[model samples]
Target: MSKIVILGAGHAGGSAAGFLKQYGFEGEIVLAGAEQIPPYQRPPLSKAWLKGETNENALQLRSSEFYAENNIDLRLGIAATAIDRTAKMVAFDDGTVEPYDYLVIATGSRARKLPLPGGDDDLLLELRTIPDAERLKQALGGGKRLAVIGGGYVGLEAAASARALGAEAVVIERMDRVLQRVASSTLSEFFTRRHTREGVIIRTGAEVVAVSGHSVTFADGEVLEAHAVLVGIGATANDELALQCGLECAEGIVVDLDARTSDTAIFAIGDVTRRPLPHYDVMHRLESVPNALEQAKRVACAITGRPAPQDEVPWFWSDQYDCKLQIAGLPFGASAQVVRGDSDTGSFAVFHLKDDRIVCVEAVNAAHSFMFGKQAIAKSSRVDAATLADESIPIKETLL
Candidate 1:
């Protein structure tokens, strides 16, 4: 029987293994992971998991028996050290070698840490793994303070969670506004207002020069002391194994729509791949659960000789303090934005239009707008901006 080896058994890799079986591949599936535990959800680590609203049992993607019953050889607590593309073998940290008819890379990304002068690396925490979340949770509550070094989604989510646990939270951002890289200015302002209303201090345009123990020093000579510090600047793709094997890579492992890397026998997915957008001409590395699940289906179809799944409009969601933010598609080259509903009411949708067509939608507690906007973007339907912006008009009627 042909054997398929999947490395980095996270969401993408784990799901791919299950999908191959679901698609009737009739092949040997070997899923290897660096973590000792079964594949679990990472998104909740900064939200529900951190706030003690969820447990480990809820985080697992699949039960242990599912892999055993499915005949998948799930190897955990081992890291792939090198890949021998010529021999079609992979060497693991445990001194084991695995040969495969096909290989899937889903190494994912790692949290980016700032190199400070104080050499206090141990004092800083990150929320990429279960252990990291556990550590941070243990350090929170009882009026403890958390100093977040970045104002991205992860940072903001953790701040909200910290506040939920009765801990003070302060977010320090280097950019001019929070979520500057990913969100529009209006959304950023909305979140800033909400977080502030909830007693979270947000420091934008602040540069951190050093971190000493529990003290974070700013370039402008401001010092903030906290019980714990979290570094959530961004993530770097874990494409080192692909690079060592001489695969084509730019910012991440370069792959086509089918998730096939430069090497025909090797495929990459999830945060490790720089994949092409469905309708857009550009390629992007999207780090979202939706992207991982979509690419997992793509890899399974590619390996099993099945028809490729329909291209989907990329979407993501975040839950912070009773507000649910749903974003769909990229706002690339958008010339105008239309706001539906009212921001002050804690419910609204920002539609980004490119050439009079809906390109992206950022919806806050507006499920109807998000769903409609997502479908419109997928269909590439043009919209009447005035109709879309008018709260009196039904969302479905706004489409041209």
Candidate 2:
């Protein structure tokens, strides 16, 4: 019997394993992970779970019973230390090896840390894994003060959760505005104002020179003190395993449209892969659950002798306080943008257009616009800016 080994039992790896069985693959499947816990949802680590609204059982992607019933060998509490590509073997940290007819690398990214002068203190915390979230959750109790190092989604979400727990949050961003890397200035300004109104202090265009204890000093000699500091700068792809195995890597493991790595026997997906977005004519390392699920489906179909899954208009969402922000499509190179609804009313959608063609949509509390915008982008439908700007007209009618 053929054996398939999947490294990293996170969303991508775990989903791929289930998909393989769903697609009628009778071969042996091994799901290996470093964490002893079964695969669980990571997004909730910063939102509902952190706020104590959900329990550990609610975060699990699959229960232990499901894995055993499916005949998947669950190798937990150990990591793939090395990949001997030529030998078709994977060596683990616990002095064991597994041979495979095929390999799938789903090792996700790691939380990036601040490279400050005094950043080595144990007081600094990151919110990535279950353990990280548990520690941060403990620190969030009793109206503690939180000093966030970055103003991105992770940072902002944590700040929101901190505020919900009666803790004071102060977000220090090195850029001119929050969400600078991913969102538009209009959206950034809206979030900045919203966070500020919620009693979270936001410092923009400020550089951090050092971090001493819970005190953070800026380049201009400004100081911010708190009980605990959370670093949400970003994440670095865990591509060392791919690189060491002589696979092509740049920013992440470079995979083709089919999610195949440089070596034919290997495939990569999820946050660890720099995959080609054919529609956008660019490569993107998308870190959304939808993207991971889509790639997982594609790989499963390929291995099962089925046609590739149809491409989708990539989308993502974030929950901060009561606001629901949903983004559809890539917003790069947009020549113009149109705003519908009213930001003052906390319901609006920003439509990004390139040569009068809709490329992206950022919807805040506007589900109809997001649903319609996703369809428009997938179909490459044209839209009239005048009609899109008019909220009186239905979003479905805007598509040409």
Candidate 3:
């Protein structure tokens, strides 16, 4: 029987392994990941896990018994060193060489390193792992001051959690607005307001120059003082192994619509792939649980001689303090945001339009709008902002 080797046991790697078996890929399937912990939900790590709202029991993605029953050769805590495309095998640090008929390059990304000079200590943390979250959680106890550098989702979430933990949290962002690059200014304003009302300090257009003993000095000569510092800027693709193998790589490993790489026998998914997305398309390296799992399932189907799954609008959600922010689709260069309710109430849906068509919808504390908007976006549903903002007409009817 031919062997199928999957690198990186996170959501994409592990999910593909299980689905390959579930879909009747009758061969050896081995899953490898750098982290020792099994594939668990990651979005919650920054949200629920940081707030003391989740336990270790709630983080398990699958029971150990399930792996045993499925006979998956699960290898954790071992990192893949390189891919020997010519040899058709994967080399690990442990001197183990696994030959494979099919190789899946799901080696996800790592937190983009902060280039600030000075004060590199073991105490400083990045919230990408269970161990990292534990350390952050412990540091979040009362009276701790956290200076979070970066105003993206992770940074904002960390700030919110730090505030909830009775700490003085300050967010330093290079962008002019929180989540400015990712969402509209309207949504950014709403989130910024939420963070401010929760007693979290935010500094937009601020850049960290250095870190020195509970203090982060900014380029503007402003110094931020804190007990602990958490950085959540973004992540860089873990493509050294792939790049060394001479695989086609851009900002990420380049993959086609089928998520297959330049080499048909090899494929990539998740945050590593430079998706073959067209103009006005935003499929490039989406860092969400849904994107990882969905692409993995598609790769599984491809490997199993089945049809690939259709690519839909990628969505993401975040839980901060007491509010849940759900995004329905990617809205690039969208012109209008029709709001039905007030941003203060946290009960509104922001409709994004492209060429006068509803391209995406963002909801806060509105689940029905999210569900309805998702279906509409999937169907390329055209609904005027006025009608979408009315809240009187059923959103589903807009799909027609």
Candidate 4:
């Protein structure tokens, strides 16, 4: 029987293992993870789970019984020490070695820390793992003061959750606007106003110079006090494993459409992989669950001698203070943008167009628009900007 060993055991690793069995691969499958817990969802770590609306049980992707019943050797709380490509073996930290015909790397990513002075203070926390969420959750309660560093999705979501818990949340962003790297100015302004209304103080263009305990000093000589500091800058891909094994790696492990790394024996998935976009020729390292699941399915099919699944149009969603924000496609080269609804009412969708074709959609509290926009972008459908911008017309009708 062929032996397939998967590292990470996060969403991508776990899904690949389950799908391998479903595809009738009677191979010996081993899933190893650094976390003590079973494969669970990470999206809720900053939102629902942090708010105490759900427990660890709800976070699990598969039950402990499922792994046993499926004949999967699930190893938890164990880290893969190194990969020996020549020997086709993986060395574990516990001095155990696992030989495999195929190896999949789904190591995911770690939360990036701030580089400013005193950024490593104990009170400065990052939310990437369950333990990180637990620590942040404890601080969220009792109406404590929260100073969030960074204006990305993680930081914004943390601020929203803190405010929901009756905490005084102050978001300090160095950029001129929050989400400046990923979102448009209009969308950023909308979220800023929304957060402001929720009693969350948003300070854009404010650079942090130092962090000491619960105090954050800005470059502009402004100091902010908080019970705890949450750093949600971004994440760094876990690509050291690939680099150590002589795989071509940039910001992430470079993978082809087949999810194969430079070493064909090894494949990569999840946030750790830098893959080519479906339509665009450029490589993108997506951190969303949809991207992870899609790559997992694709890798499974390829391993089972089946046709690889078609590359999907990447989509992601976030919930903050009763607002559901759904984004579709990558808008890196967007030339035009159309607003479909009122931003003041906190319900709108920003349609990004390139060469008269829909490329991306940023929908806030607009599900129907997001669904249609996602499909339209996937199909490379072209629509008139006037029609797309018209709220009077249904998004479904706007599809070309």
Predicted structure with the largest lDDT when compared to the true one: 1
In model 3, residue pairs whose N, Cα or C atoms come closer than 3 Å (at least 3 residues apart or on different chains), thus clashing, are 9-33
The alpha-carbon deviation from the true structure for residue 68 of candidate 4, after best TM-score superposition, in angstroms, is 1.2
Q: Tell me the lDDT of candidate 1.
A: 0.93
Question: Each candidate's lDDT (Cα)?
Answer: 0.93, 0.89, 0.81, 0.89
Model 2 has an lDDT value of 0.89
For residues 1-400, could you state the per-residue lDDT of candidate 4 as single tens digits?
Answer: 8899999999999999998988888889999999998899988988998788898888898888999898899999899989999999999998899999999999999988778789778778998888889999888865599999899888889888888888999998988999999998889998898899999899988978899669899877978888999888889999998899899999999999888999888999999999999766689899989999988888889899988887688899988888899999889689999999998888999988997788899999988888888888778888988888898887767766
Off by over 4 Å in 1: none
Per-model TM values vs. the true structure: 0.98, 0.98, 0.94, 0.97
What are the per-residue Cα lDDT tens digits for candidate 1 across 156-213?
9999999999999999998999999999998999999999999999999898999965
- lDDT by residue (76-161, candidate 2, tens digit) is 89999899998999999999999998899999999886787877777789988888888888888656898999999999999999
- Give a tens-digit lDDT track for model 3, residues 1-400: 8788889888788788778888887787888888888877777888789888897768877787767677778899898897889889889998899998989988888887677686465566788888989988887878788988789889998888788778889898988998987887878999899999999999998877888547889887877777888877889998888899999999789888777898888989888888854334654777778878888888888878888777666789988877888998778777777776678788888888885576778888999888877777776667766666776777765553
TM-score computed on alpha carbons, candidate 3: 0.94
Backbone Cα, N, C clashes tallied per candidate: 0, 0, 1, 0
In terms of lDDT, the poorest run of 10 residues in model 3 is 276-285
Candidate 4 regions with alpha-carbon error over 4 angstroms: none
- CA RMSD (A), model 2: 1.2
> Considering every candidate listed, which one attains the maximal TM-score?
1
TM-score of 2: 0.98
- Deviation of model 2 at 246, angstroms: 0.7
Report clash pairs, candidate 2: none
Native-to-model Cα distance after best TM-score fit, residue 282 in candidate 2, in Å: 0.8
